[model samples]
Target: MRNIYFVRHSIQDLSVQDDASAPLTKAGNVLAKELTRLFINKSITAIYSSPYARAFQTVLPTAEKLDLIIDTHADLRERQAIWRLDWQEHLANLWQDFELKADGEESFADVERRIVPAFQQIYDDTEGDIIITGHGTALSVLFHHLTHGQFTFSDWQNMNMPDVYIGHFSDENVLVGLEKIAR
Candidate 1:
């Protein structure tokens, strides 16, 4: 079995305003330190993260602690929800019906297409445990795909910032077990 972990970025400093450049908050920095503790003896082979600063920062502690290089992937970014109204509701509907999309938003299907392969490629190309630092919605969609819909929208809603989801996969890429590593 192979293990892969997805670590959602810690709280962002909303004051920074830029989506891609916003760094984590001071408390989020503390969370990143705590994040490092999860990989203490896991022998993680590589660290991958969304290009966003907050997501990258969340996993930086662990990468530095393990002396591993952090790889960035554009597809791992937060779901583009630039639509003007009730974005959360729109997102929920989009998740429920993967094809729904606002004019400027990336639909769930679109995101699935982009991220799932990126995720699988990382898994297929790596050995040992792997850690991926990603955004909430994007991770949720990817998780849903990986677990074959065993996780739900409510699960997505309940996710905490800086959450960890560990997945065990078979050689054929079938998920055998999925566990949420408590923060």
Candidate 2:
């Protein structure tokens, strides 16, 4: 069994108002510290993160503890918008706008394309546990893909900041189990 841990980056300071450079807030920092402690005892063989500051920040503490430099993957960045819209208005139309791909952002399908290859590469190269830190919406789509579309929006809603999901893959690359980690 191969174990993959998908961890959402901690709470971002939405006050930043920028798309790419938002940093983690004070609460996010606290959460990262706690997550670091939780990860310290585990055998994490590889650490991968999105290029975004917030996502990198979330994995930094754990990376430090493991003395492993994070491997940044551009494909892991948060979903990009194909069109510019007011952030608040975007939130209101989130699930309703299936055709509304943001101008500068990647659509959900775009995210899936990159995410699958990233995970596949890791699975091919590693025999032990692998950890990935990324954004919420992107992670949600990833979870759905990993579980073969068993996860849904309601499942995404139940997840909290720094949430961890475990995926167990068989030798044939089929997912055997997809479960949320309580921690």
Could you say which candidate leads in TM-score? 1
Worst 10 residues of 1 by lDDT: 83-92
Per-residue lDDT over 6-76 for candidate 2, one digit per residue giving the tens place of the 0 to 100 score: 88988899889786799999999889878876678778899999999988998898899899889888878
Q: Clashing pairs in model 2? A: 80-105, 80-106, 81-102, 81-103, 81-104, 81-105, 82-102, 82-103, 83-102, 83-103
Error of 1 at 134 (Å): 0.2
| Backbone clash count for every predicted candidate, in the order shown | 0, 10
Please report how far candidate 1 places residue 33 from its true position, in Å. 0.7
Model 2 weakest 10-residue run by lDDT = 91-100
Candidate 1 lDDT, 122-155, residue by residue in tens: 8878888899999988998998887789888989
Most accurate candidate by lDDT: 1
Error of 2 at 156 (Å): 1.6
